[model samples]
Target: MDNPSLFEQLGGERELRTIIDEFVDRVFDDVMIGFFFQRASRERLKAKEYEFAAEHLGGPVTYSGRPIAQAHAAHPIMGGQFMRRLRILEEVLEAHDVSPAVREHWLAHTEGLRAMVTRDSGGRCDPVDAMKRVQERGKE
Candidate 1:
């Protein structure tokens, strides 16, 4: 048999939705990054997240939302916020018992979208430094 796609490896749509639901919920509630989403629609966020992940994982869905950069253009997301969101995703994946392969692929894909989502280069910034940068940038 041919190898299953990452979507199939993830138990397909229902399972992926479950994971995304929890992930989005945590993101909306996260102290570090929650404010960014305060004015956004939770359901819309979940739906768009599902489409994005589904398409990337080789499912039969395509993302129909705004481009990543356009979608985030208004948000002054800092490296700290981006990294916090990534950590939340990692925790959610671990909690859902996602396989290592899927976890790695998902994380890598997310990291690749960082530039489109934020000007901040995230992985290097410790929390204090990231906050400092955010504050400094706000003054510019």
Candidate 2:
């Protein structure tokens, strides 16, 4: 059995970048979250996503700017919003035909960041509820 780290399972930076790109594209189309990205460009967001993935996957830290928590501190996203983003992210992964093992691996790795991200988003979100939604989704 191949017990690869989530980073290895994801095929390293290139594959992670691809996944983030695809996921962000879907986010751009989501009416609820799209507005949040109105002032951002795909390229910039892509770079940010890449940095985030790299950091979480135990790779070199490419994100050297302000911490995510401070950056999104004013965004009023709550548990429901986080759930919505997760749903969209999952949909993108599925649509892109990402392998189930790889998808699950990455999701598991990234799941821990929910509280950090939401809290940084100004505590507008309920971490407990966000965790519940993540658990519920995992059951599907």
Candidate 3:
């Protein structure tokens, strides 16, 4: 048999959705990254996340969202926030019993996407505080 795609290795669409559901839930509860997701519709977000993951993992789905950088540019996401979210992902994958090789492959792909996801070079500034500072700077 031909080698399985990463999407298949990770259990295809249904299983991936389960993982993303829990992953997004964990993210919503996290203080550092939760600030950025306060208004997210979990249902909608799950679909979009699955599509993005499917496309990246060589699945059959096409990702129809905006470009990654354009999508994240609205947020002042620090490098630290990105790392925190990634750790949450690792935890979720571990909980789901995904294999180590698959997890590492997934992590490497995601880590490579950091530049596109993070607009802030600053590490760990509270996004709300960062925005306030920008407004304060403009007032001066």
Candidate 4:
């Protein structure tokens, strides 16, 4: 039998939406990174984040947001900021009691996007390759 996709493992759209809703609120209100989203629409960001996560997690959803690189290009994000966002995500995941496998995959996928989101790649980020992996995630 084929393995269940990550989306299924994550409890489908309803549960995923619940998780994303909380995560987005926390991210938007985060003292360390909330400034980045001061001008952004909370509702729109939530929608896009839901789409993005749904797609990557193997749901039958498409992310309609702009490409990651283009979307984040206007921001002057640093490595520390990126790491802070990851920490926030980690905490959110733990609070939600996300399955270990799903949590690791999601975090790794976000880490892979660091190059596209920030400039401190440490010479290891290849945004192109990362996007390719993201596009291929649900297929596996």
Query: lDDT rank, highest first?
Result: 1, 4, 3, 2
Per-residue lDDT over 1-140 for candidate 2, one digit per residue giving the tens place of the 0 to 100 score: 36666567667778778888888887877887787778879888888888877776666566765776687777766655666687777787787677787677657655555776664442435456768989999999
Candidate 2: where are CA atoms >4 Å away?
Answer: 1-4, 97-102, 119-140
Worst 10 residues of 2 by lDDT: 119-128
Q: Write the per-residue lDDT of candidate 4 for residues 26-123, one digit (tens) a residue.
A: 98998888999999999999899999998999999999999999999999887777877888888988998889999999999998898899866624
Q: Best candidate, TM-score-wise?
A: 1
Give the 10-residue window scoring lowest on summed lDDT in candidate 4. 121-130
What local lDDT score does residue 42 receive in model 2, on the 0 to 100 scale? Answer: 83
The 0-to-1 C-alpha lDDT of every candidate, in the order given, reads 0.90, 0.72, 0.84, 0.87
* Residues 1-140 of candidate 1: C-alpha lDDT, one tens digit per residue: 39998999999999999999999999999988898898899999999999999999999999999999999989988766788888999999999899999999999999888888776654445586768889999999
lDDT of 3 by residue, 1-140 (tens): 39998889989988898999999888888977897888878778788888988888889999988888898888888787988888899999999998887799888888888888887753544556778999999999
The alpha-carbon deviation from the true structure for residue 140 of candidate 3, after best TM-score superposition, in angstroms, is 40
C-alpha RMSD for every candidate: 5.6, 6.7, 7.6, 10.9
- In model 3, which runs have C-alpha deviations exceeding 4 angstroms? 122-140
lDDT leader: 1
| lDDT score for residue 100 of model 1 | 94
With candidate 1 superimposed using the best TM-score fit, by how many Å does residue 75's alpha carbon deviate from the native?
A: 0.4
How many Å off is the CA of 83 in candidate 2?
0.8
By descending TM-score, how would the candidates be arranged? 1, 4, 3, 2
Question: What 10-residue stretch in candidate 3 is worst by lDDT?
Answer: 120-129
